[model samples]
Each structure stands twice: as C-alpha cells, then as structure tokens.
Target: MWHGDRNGHGEGGGRGSAQGWCALALLHGKIEAHLERELQGAHGLSVREYSLLDVLSRQNSGEGGHLRMGEVAEAVVLSQSATTRLVTRLEDRGLLSRYLCATDRRGIYTDVTRAGLELLERARPTNDAALSEALDAAEGRPELASLVAVVRAL
Candidate 1:
C-alpha cells in the first residue's frame, strides 16, 4: 500500500523519510562499489584487506611488525571476529601471521610478513592512483573537507 502524499510531498512520512534513507544508502553503495572495483582490479585485495594492511604498515617498526589484533580491528573499523577472519585469509596467502601476545596470552597480535610488505608496496601505486582520482573528483569542494571533518568528529 502506498502511503505517500498524493502530491508526492512529505505528508505521510516520519522524521526519517524514505528519500533520506535512500540517499544515504546510495552514497554508501557508490563508495563501496568504487573501492571494491579499484581494489579488485588494481590490487588483489578488497577494501577491508587493504585497510588492514595499511594499518599494519603504518605501525611497522625497524625490528619486526607487530600490532594487537583488537587494536587493528578498531583502527580498521571491523569487528574483532571479522578481523580474525581477514587475518586468517591474509595468513593463508602468506601476507601476514598471527600469534599470542607475550604480555598477555589471552591477547593476540598480528605481524606483517615480508610477503605482506611486498604486497603493500605493489598495491601502493594503485591505491595512490585511486586516491588521486577521488581527490580530483572532490577538487575545489569544501564539502569534501567538511565531510571528512564530520566523520572524524564521530
């Protein structure tokens, strides 16, 4: 049954209307599709996998690569269980490894392998290209910066 206004106005909707929800859904879908296509075509990684690798690469030190699994999950905006699954997949592909935390056996840590570092290096150019395209699309638009600031505020 159609409960919308006869004149297609907001006469029959709640605070959060269908149009507003649809706009948000479309925005999310576009971003996800863009990232997915770029990652799959340019690098053999998905957005989630790339995000995990990026976080670990930033955390890398001179000696060895190590980051807490929970911390990585939080940084990458994934659930701990989902992060574990991603880590498992990366490990199977010789990209990373996981181990128990020395300080606390109950805690787990992840380390990027040499292969992982190599993959990150390989994917850098493609990621840079994608980011450049996205930035160019947002060029001269203050809304881009405003959107970033708003997300960061959250």
Candidate 2:
C-alpha cells in the first residue's frame, strides 16, 4: 500500500513523517510523467495543454464556451500569465478563441473551438488508458486504489 509499508510505517511512516508525503508525491510525479509522454506522442499535446482544452470543453456559452482568464488559470492550475500564453498558442492553432468579457470589460474569456473539443475527445482514450495502466500497476493493493478514489473525488 502507498501510505506506509505493511510494517505500519506506510503512508507517511510512523506518526506521519515526511517520507509518506514524499512517497505520495513520487507516485504522483511518476504517473504524471508517464501520462505526459503518452499524451504527447499520441496526440501532439502535453498533459497540461490537454488539461486546458478539457477545462474549456466543459464550459458553456452556447457556441462560445467561455471562461474568464483567471478561472481558466485556476482550473488548469496555472498562473494567469501562463494561461494567457497557452491560450494564445491555442488561439493560433484555431483550437481556442479569446474575447473580452461582455459585461466586464477587463475580464477576458477563453473559449474552446470545435477543433479543440475534437482533439480533446480524441486524446481522452490515451489519457484514460495511460492513467489506467498507472493505477493498474497498483492493483494488488487496495490502499492505492483508495487513494485513487480520493483523488478522483477531488
């Protein structure tokens, strides 16, 4: 199991030491790295880039699919400036469109284009398969699956 070893020093080690957190972080990092490569090779998109697309795809504004620049950053776990850069790249590719907020002039929204939605749909199988493979590697242990459940809930 991930929390700690069978000896009870598992999750974080006895009394919740940093080792457990480190272990968790390590597992997360490894899986993310693997998924990053898988997504990139198959779809020409990084995990983070695809994540931005996924977030926009879920938003709605009829044909617009708009989200505030800041909201986009939060949903994608990026700084606003970084989100802007990514959004610009998507804009260049016709995968997304950005516009000023109608009611609030200062608020800029980014929307997923039809092409972006299509790409995200195509990439989902690769994303899911890689994630499943990563989790399946932990299948013999229930604790790891529990952790996955917790993450999915979040």
Candidate 3:
C-alpha cells in the first residue's frame, strides 16, 4: 500500500504504487513505440488505425452485436469525436464501414471491411513480434523485468 508520502514516495520499504505506475507507463510507452514503428513500416498503418481495425473486426453481425462510437472510443482509449474521425479515416481507406443500426436509426455501428480484415491479419504477426521483442528488451532492464514477467504471465 502507498503511504502517500510528500514526495510521492511510499513510506514502506517499497517505492509504492506511484513507482509501479511509472514503471507501467514506461513499459507501455516502450511497447507502443516499438509496435508503432513495426506496424507503420510494414503495414502502412498507424498503431491507432490498426487497433481500430482489430477492435471493429471482432464485432458480430447479430442483433446488438456491434459497438457504438462510445464503445469504440472506450476500447481505443480515444475521445468520442476522435473515434469518429478515426472511423472516417479508415472508412475512406476502404478498411471500415459505418451503418445505421436497424433497431435504432440514431445509433451508428462500425465494422471492419474485407480490406481491413486482410490488413489486420497481415499486421497481427508484426504486432505480436514487435511486442515480444519489446518485452524481451525490457526484461533486461532491472526496473522493467518484473513488469515484463507479469505481462508474460498474463
């Protein structure tokens, strides 16, 4: 538990949750940067675009099976407007499609197009490989080794 010390440090022997949070943030940044470089170079897609495609591709066509813009935003960790813009960009690239919900005309659902699925399939390996490479590199660091192990366990 965090002691909530004045310097944001823990009072116990440990550095506390703040330090853990920083470590997690650092690991995330490293992994994201590695994935971004690999995905962008090999697939001509940004990390966000690839993530959007991956998220949308998992939706079912059955009743209430698709994600709304708000849900997509939550999944992608983006704002609602930002998710809409990302959807528009992918739609323009023929990677995604948006349509009105059958039961609720006011609701719009987004799905991955064939092109998006193909691209996602192609990029999946790259993303996985880059993530492994990042974790491997981070594992060598004393500060990140435990986090890397936790991630691998997960």
Candidate 4:
C-alpha cells in the first residue's frame, strides 16, 4: 500500500492529513515516471506528446482528424502557447499538420497525420500497461483509491 500506518489521530489529524497528501504526491510521481519511461521506449513519445496525439486521434468530427488548438490545450492542461510549440514540433516530425480555421481565422486546427496515428497506436499498449500497473497498485489501498477518485472526478 502506498500509505503507511495512519498515525492514530482520528479524523482531524493523521489519515487525511499531511501523510496522505505526501503519499498521493509520491504515487502520482511514480505513475508519471513509469508512463514517461514506457512511452519513450515503446514509441519515442513523451507522455505530453503522446497525450497530444491521443487528443487529435480521438477527435470524431470535422475535416481530417482535427481539433482546435485551444480545445486541445485545455484538454491536455497545457498553455495555448505551449500547445502551439508542441504542435510545431509534431508538424516538423511529420506526425501532424496544422491549418488555420476557416471560420475563425485566428484559430488553428491540428490533425494527426498517418505517422502520428501509427505512433499513437504503437504506444497504446505501453500506455495501457502503465495504467494497469498504477491501478493495481492503487486498488486495494483506501487512501490511493480516494486520491484517484478525486483526480478522476476533476
């Protein structure tokens, strides 16, 4: 279990206090590290890059496999400028293409190219495995479950 013995301080002090917060931080860090390693080894993608590709590939509407840059940035918790830079990197790698949104000229849309989709598909297994491992580690632990539920709810 990720959390240690609940220092016997009842509801006001121990279990739900500093120790719990620390445990949650540690677990989140571990999961991110595992994901970073797996994605890099399996498909040469960082976790952020894989997430961007995933956001593009999972889009179900409009011209190409595309989504507005702002929407993608919001979905991936990135700043718009950061997303723009990331998109540029992907564009350079031939993983994706960008176009100005016709109706909203200032807006940019990003679409996954064949290479991007291929990389995302290739990375899926590793991502799934990392998630499974993290879930397994969290499942039997009450504190971890609570933390996971909170994050998921967000």
How well is each residue in 1-154 modelled by candidate 2, as lDDT tens digits?
3666667675545755554565567568767888899999999998889999998888877655567788889998999999889989888999998888887899787778889989999999999999888766654455455566666677
Clashing pairs in 3: none
Candidate order by TM-score, highest to lowest? Answer: 3, 2, 4, 1
TM-score of each: 0.67, 0.78, 0.91, 0.75
Best by lDDT: 3
Candidate 2 Cα RMSD after full superposition onto the native fold (Å): 6.0
Candidate 4 has which clashing residue pairs, if any?
A: none
Segments in model 4 whose C-alpha atoms lie over 4 Å from true places = 1-20, 63-66, 138-154
* Candidate number with the higher TM-score (1 or 4): 4
User: Model 3: per-residue lDDT, tens digit, 30-121?
Assistant: 99999999999999998899899988988898876799999999999999999999999999999998899888899999889889899999
- The models' CA-based lDDT, in order, is 0.74, 0.81, 0.92, 0.82
For residues 96-118, what per-residue lDDT tens digits would candidate 1 score against the true structure? Answer: 88778676899777878899998
Q: Candidate 3, 151: how far from true, in Å?
A: 1.2
Per-residue error for 127 in candidate 4, Å, reads 0.4
Predictions: Cα RMSD each: 6.5, 6.0, 2.3, 6.6
> Which digits, one per residue and each the tens of the lDDT, describe model 4 over residues 27-74?
787778889988898788898999999988888665654567778999
Stretches of candidate 2 above 4 Å error? 1-17, 62-65, 138-146, 152-154
lDDT comparing candidate 2 with the true structure: 0.81
Candidate 4 TM-score, true structure as reference:
0.75
Each model's backbone clash number: 0, 6, 0, 0
How many pairs of residues collide in model 1?
A: 0
Pull out the clashing pairs in model 2. 3-10, 3-11, 4-10, 4-11, 5-10, 12-20
